[model samples]
Target: MLHRLFILLIAIVGLAACSGGNNFSSGGATDVARSYTLADFSFAAPADLTVSESENYYPFADVVWRGDPRGARVPQIAAMFETAARRSATGLTGDVPVAVQVRLVRFHGVTDRTRYSVGGNYHIVFDMTVRDARTGTVLEPARRVTANLDAPGGSRAVALEQGGQTQKVRVVNFLTEVLLAELS
Candidate 1:
C-alpha cells in the first residue's frame, strides 16, 4: 500500500515537471523578422523567439528556462556559425580559413509593440570568439550579439517560434556581418 502511494506521488510530480506551468494564449501572432542582414553570410528566418512568450524562460522575471535540459539548439547554432566563420570569403578559392567559438546566454525581453509581431520586446545575447585557423591567433574577443524582434501578438507559440529560430539567425547574421566587416 505504501509503495502504491509513493508511485502515485512520483507520477504526479513527473507530470507537473513536464508541463510548463504557464497559461499561454494562442490567439495573437506575428513574425518578428522574416529575415535579417549580414555581410558575407545571410540566412532566412521564420520568426523571432520572444523571451517573454517563452513559458519557461522569463528573462524579466529573473528566471532562466532550459527548454532542453541537454542544451541543444544553442550548440547547433554555434557550430553553424563557426563553420561559416571558417569558410573563405571568396566563392570557392582564395578564402582565408578561420575558426570561431560561440556562446549563447540567456535572453532579455523588452516591450516593443511596433517592431515585433510578438507585441513585446525581445533581446538575446550570443557571445563569440574568432581565431585564425592556421596561426591559431585570437582574431576577436568574445562578442555579444543582441537583437529585438516584433511580437505583435500575445501568443506563446508565436513567441517561441520567433525567439527560437528568427532571433538566432539575426544574431548569427549580425556576427557574420561584423566579422566580414573586419576582414574587409
Candidate 2:
C-alpha cells in the first residue's frame, strides 16, 4: 500500500507541473522597450544657414529579408532624414547661406534566438556635415550619430517591424537635437 501511494504522489506532481499556465511552446514572451532622451547640444550656427540635401549610402540597395525588399527600406530611411532636416529648419529665417548634408553610414538589423527571447536589436549610424554654400569649405567636420534600438515581438518579422519603427523615432530625435544644437 505504501508503494502504491508513492507512485500516485509522483503522478500528481507531474500533472501539476505540466498544467502550469506559463508555457514556452506557444511562443508567449515579453521584452522591455528601451527609452531615450535628447542630449543638450550647445553649438552656434550661422544666421543664414540652411539644409541642402540628405543622402543614403546603405550598401544593400536591392536586398530583401522576410518578404520585405531593400528598395523599400532604403528610400524610407532617406526620406526620414530629409523630413527631419526640413522640420528642424522650420523656425530659422535665413538666405540658405549654408547647407547641411546628411549621410547614412550603416543600418543593421539582426535576430538571434540565443541572444534575445522575444526580439532582436537594430543599429543605425549616420553623419552630418556642414559646408559653405558657395565655396564648399567645411564649416564643421562630419558629426557621427548612432542609435541601438530594441525590437520586441513574438516573431522575426514582427521584431524587425518594431525595430524599424523604433529607428524612425530615434533618427527624428537625433536629427532634431543636432539641428537645434548646432544650427539654431
Candidate 3:
C-alpha cells in the first residue's frame, strides 16, 4: 500500500512536470526566418536555450495583437517573419548574406468587422537589427519599424483570400517587401 502511494505520487509529479511547462522552439510552425513570442501578449521562453548569431533567432516581447484569433501564437508569427526574411534574402547580391534580428512589438490584422467592411491595416511593429551572416557583425543597429499595409476588405478581401492571398500571405509579402527595402 505504501509502495503504491509512492509510485502514484511520482507519476503525478512527472505528469505535472511535463504538462506544466511551455517551451520555446527555434523554428516557427512550418520550419521557416527563425522565430522571432505569448498570450496576454506575453511570452516566456524555455530557460535552456541561448541566443546565438549563426542560428537565426527573433526575440520577442509582449505582443499586442488586436482582432487576431485566440490561437495566434508567437511561434507562428515568428515563422511568418522568418519566411519573409528568407524570401528577401534572395535579393541579396553579395556572397555573405544578412540576418535580420526582429523583436516583434505589435500586430493587428483585419478584424472580422474591418475585413467585411472598408478594410484595415495590418499594423505590425518591430525592432529590427541587420547583421552579417558570416561575421555576426551588426550591419545596422536595432531600429523600430512599422510594417503596415492595406488589408483588402469586403468582397476584395474574400476574393483575395480565396485566391490564396490570405492574411498570412499578405503579411508575409508585406514583410518581405519591408525587409528588402530595409536591407537596401
Per-residue CA lDDT of model 3 for 138-181, tens digit only, reads 65667767665776659998899789888787777877787666
Task: TM-score for candidate 2, please give it.
Answer: 0.43
Model 1 spans with C-alpha error above 4 angstroms: 1-95, 108-118, 154-184
Pairs that collide, model 2: none
lDDT of each: 0.40, 0.44, 0.55
Winner on lDDT between 2 and 3 is 3
Span of ten consecutive residues with least summed lDDT in model 2: 21-30
Model 1, span 43-112: residue lDDT tens: 2222343324333222333212232233534344445456455442432232444554545554433322
Give the residue spans of candidate 3 off by over 4 A. 1-72
Stretch of 10 with least lDDT, candidate 3 = 35-44
Give per-model TM-scores.
0.38, 0.43, 0.60
Candidate 1 lDDT for residue 121: 34
Total clashes in model 2, counting residue pairs 3 or more apart in sequence or in different chains: 0
Query: Better model by TM-score, 1 or 3?
Result: 3
| Alpha carbon deviation, residue 17, candidate 3 (Å) | 46
